[model samples]
Target chain A: MRKNDMRPDELLKMDRRLVLSATGGMAAVMLPVVLTSFIVSETARVVAAVLVYAAAIIMAWAFVKRYVGILNAQHRESEKKHLSEIAMLVQPITTHLNNRALIIPVLTNQLNEVTKQTESAALDIGEKFMSIVQRARNQAKKASGAFGRFAGNGGSSSESLTDLSKKALSDVIESLRDMVGVTSQTLKNMEVIIEDAGNIKRIVTEIEYIAEQTNLLALNAAIEAAHAGEQGRGFAIVADEVRKLSDRSNAAADDIRKLISRVETDIKGIYSKTEKSITESSARSLEAETVVNDTLRKIDDVIGEVKKQLDELGAETESLAKDISSIVISMQFQDITRQRIEHVIEPLMSFKAELEDITQKARSMSEKIHEWEGNSSAEWLEKMYTMESEREVLKEVLKNG
Target chain B: MGKTVLIVDDSASMRQLVSFALRDAGYDVIDAINGKDAMSKLNGTKIEMVITDLNMPEMDGIEFIKQVRNNPGYKFTPIVMLTTESQESKKQEGKQAGASGWIVKPFTPEQLIDIVKKFAR
Candidate 1:
């Protein structure tokens, strides 16, 4: 009989009655009646011996049988206890196995896919960074070359700084575009997974519904098999088997439900990740755009300021020209005063000449640096840096002036 | 060009997975269900590498490795033990039984391929 089919109360009832019956009336008859019949005679001695022996044997057999039966009952009780323990452990074990069995495959597939995605992402980021570095390196080389030129002959410095800023801005924008591409592609893939998971959830729920129907059908079959009584013994076993399988299948469906829920959760997680990645990419793009705009604004502002300074220098230069013209024209009539003015004017003109050369070199170096930034041309970059250092010297001369 | 390898494990699914990865990495592969069956396949095959499980029935992997080592057909074959168990005695036994290397189970494709490439023909 099936363990579940047996009732504990009924078992206890039968066990108690069995132990009591053997020691009761059977013991009463076997113990006394035969001993009382024993008499003193040769034939009677044999007959009495036989009767007493028979009583003892019967009583002994009954006692031993009861003891063994009780022993068996105890053993059965222990076995039942063991079964319960096993049953309790069964859920976790089955659940664990079921989870592992599904999870291994699901995660394996996800890991493979995600690894591919992340590797590509990392590669993309590395490539972007390298490109940015290359741009910066080229720009630095140009500035160095301008400095080398400028050091050889003093030149302007403001233009070179502006060129470097523009190149940095454009390069950053390019890398930002690549990052955006990767982020969008990843988001698209994640969306597809989310849709697929949703579809799978729907299918799993349908399957669960069908399993519930199957369980009900199996129950009806079991009831029908029961009504058949003796004729349905084989049918009942078959029905029971079907019912067991259905219950197991139902349990399997529940596992799938849980798995589907987990998958949906994981998909949502991935979606969130994709969203976060996109958000980060967008934010980076925005930051890059802002940097570029700010750089442009700084360049324009510096150009405007430099132009204003150059205009002031021009006005000063015009006044120096007027003073020289006046001194040359009136020098004979006012030689002493004119000579003194000439002494001061000569140095001022020398200063103006030096300033003009410095400013011209600075502009040349800036152009070379800008060219290198655009074409990544090392030759131009080398020239630009040489000019930058010259620009630095000129700025010092102007400061002294 | 890459190493030619044979993977012997009882699980069909695991075989499919490992082979998929190894093949993806450009390795030639042969497959078998278990140790006994692996031996039978090994007789006429020229597999340069063998990655086998430890706890298979009917001629377990260790015994198969021993027999393979004894046979002239595979004396120099590099045999790696792949299994889930981590008992020290089991590892020692595998090493004494002539295993070339040992790796725990649930390794990634990269890890598997990384190890395989180290001895792959």
Candidate 2:
């Protein structure tokens, strides 16, 4: 109803109900008397019957009219009360829906923002993890390659080193054997020379003895020559020739003895020097073999150490690769979590949509209530009255009144 | 050349995880960002097995599996779905698409390797 539309404030306002009761009582008293008068006066019966029917019809019409007014007034009051109650219910519902609608979008936006940020962060972490894993894998590959190369080269070098050591030992032994052969040959030659020198000394000594004998014979001949003066002169010349030959033989034997002594001394010095050289060469050959063996052993040790270090490096790289891989695996939690969050957000999005729908419904309901408020009581009753049976009851009461 | 395994996932982290695990187990791993990318990478490669995610940007795992089954080269190749989805309907779809198995997310590397070994080798 319009806000300015008001009920009457008069203390004595006669409603349709009072008019109906008064008219109903009058009809109740007059109807019976008029019927009895028609029985008593037969000649006037038609006129009295017409007057009674006319009075009854007029009272019934007034009663129906007043009762209809009562019914309309009650209907308007009930409609207004119902509309007021509906407004009271719709206001809070609209408010709640509005608040929820506002809050839901904000929540959805925040969720979206958070989801975006989480996704970005997860991507960042994944990229970093991939980088680390890639670097680690590359390093492991390089280390493995290095280790393989080192092992390969170490094997070949070790073989080469062993061959070299064997060759060096063989050369040393061969050189020692050559020195022994040369030294022995030199000694044998010196021995042969010494034997020949001895033989020469023996021959010279024999010559000297011959020369001594000749000298003795020459002396005897000279004595005999003194006894037979002139005849002995020819024999004395022969004896003197023999004495000169003997002296020359003795001088040559002395020269041969001196030469044999110096030759023997020189041969002894050469033999001593050759013996010393052979001894030193044998010792040096042994020392050289030992040195070569030591060097080979050192090379072997170095190769073994290098191999061990390479193996260790390979192992470390493998371990590092494993660790980086594990870290990458751990970082996968972000993707899983992101998917989980998206799953949760799916329902949340549905809920938001439902809330929006509810908010829209509430808004429409509120608008309907506001439109209802503009309606007059009669209009509301005409539009909202659904009880045909109640109208029939109201008509009967109206006719009885 | 070792046994080759193809890993398909939109998530880089998941791909890296699978790649690292497979590579560590002495298998050659080929990873792709999605099913479409996996298909592109699958060309001319001797792939023994495939591990793919169900949800992806271009082509999904089921469709990818179906495509792989359609291809003459990969018709008999064992394809497995790696995903967070455990729904029976999705699994049935994968199976219908010629998938060999399903492995859920957050799975252990050993679990993956064991499954790969079972099929790839």
Candidate 3:
């Protein structure tokens, strides 16, 4: 393995192996040289050989120790370089994770605030709408009540318009009948007056007849006075005066009879005209009564229609109020939606917390790369199952698997 | 005077929704955030009924119902559990804790009012 990739303990074991192999090879070579010198049987030569071997063995040991130290120094340098590279790579990721962790909570909080405000505003609008609907219902009820009072329905004490109109027409018809009765009575009186005039005419005729008879008697007396001559001369003079008086009486009687006839004719004409007028007035009065009754019937029909329409209006307003109330009830869905949103936000918060934990671990790992060992699979798996759905899925998978 | 009901839930929206439904149904309503808050609000005010959610912070519905049953004044008051939990075991737990009725979440206003009328009456 590359020195930087190798663990410090593995590098230490390799260094120990290299030092043992060098010492064993140097000992093999020195032992043989010392054996050969001892076999040569020369003391001075043997001593010099031993001295050279000792110096050579010391020099070899020193060289192996220095080489092991250089290898260890290189391994330390490589380890430092690897740790620096890991820190460089982890810095940006840690920062990104930290930033996301910080932002998620704020974002979720803002979302929660917005949701609350929207819910409140929507609830307020619903309340106001309900208030308006209630007010409208009350107003409609008031209007209907007033109309009922005007129509005299529902035990109102005041007379209805229909009743008032009928009553007024009835009074007019009664007055017309009264007038017809009076006119008929006046016509009957006129007839009676005409009959009395006829009686007076007959009386005048009798008077005329008496006056004629008296004149004749006066004429006879004058004739008798003439037949007795000279002694009857005074009586004849008186008789002549009586005869003149009788002639004037006859002329006045004739004038009186003619005046009575003219008076009877005028009375008959007045009676005929008044009787015709009374008949025509009675007919007109009946026709007017019929017309008034028809008008009253029409007024009743119109008022009945108006009252029906008002009742329908009241019913429709009540139905509308009920519909608005149902709408207000339907507004409760907002609460359900809000609960669902809360469910969603809970997992998001878990994810944010998990991310923050990972970032902290990453920072610690970067600082101690040489000593760092990554998290376990189970630890990561535990974090992955933050939501209930995810945990359910995992359960399903385990059951199936 | 209308009967009073208390609603307890961690969700504000849910509390408001229950409050609105109860108030519209001609009953007075009081609301609390959780079981602990609900416990504090039960100060001998003659609450006829209680509606509570299953899960909450600090204290939960089961424990809350137990506490309520311990109170002498509210021992007979009807307590209904309103929750998203549909598990039979959880329901049994709630029943054992003295819940009078159980209602799943997303309930209609009519259903809630009907339940209230039945139990509160």
Please give the distance, in angstroms, between residue B22's alpha carbon in candidate 1 and its true position after superposition: 85
- Runs off by more than 4 Å, candidate 3: A1-26, A29-86, A154-158, A174-292, A368-401, B1-48, B53-67, B84-93
Top candidate when judged by DockQ against the true structure: 2
Give the per-residue lDDT of model 3 (tens digit) for A54-146.
Answer: 776776676666555556555555656666687888899999999989988897898798779868976786777668767877887787677
Candidate 2 Cα outliers beyond 4 Å, as residue runs: A1-92, A98-260, A263-306, A376-401, B1-3, B26-28, B40-46, B87-89
A1-401, model 2: which lDDT tens digit per residue? Answer: 33334356421233445665776777666775757574767656767777777777777776666566655665566666677787788778867866776776677677767767766775576567657666766876676566455334544454454455566677877887788788879988998898888998999899899999999999899878877799999888888988999999999999998999899889988988987887887788788767877876776686678777767866776677666666656666777876777777778778877877877886787677666655554354443445888666655654675
**Per-model TM-score versus the true fold:** 0.28, 0.70, 0.64
Model 2 chain A scores worst on lDDT over the 10 consecutive residues at A3-12
For candidate 3, give fnat to 2 decimals.
0.37
Sliding window of 10 residues with minimal summed lDDT for model 3 chain B: B12-21
Please report the candidate that would top lDDT against the real structure.
Answer: 3
Each model's iRMS: 45.3, 2.6, 2.2
Ranking by DockQ: 2, 3, 1
Overall local distance difference test of candidate 1: 0.65
Enumerate residue pairs that collide in model 3: none
* Location of the lowest summed lDDT over 10 successive residues in candidate 2 chain B: B11-20
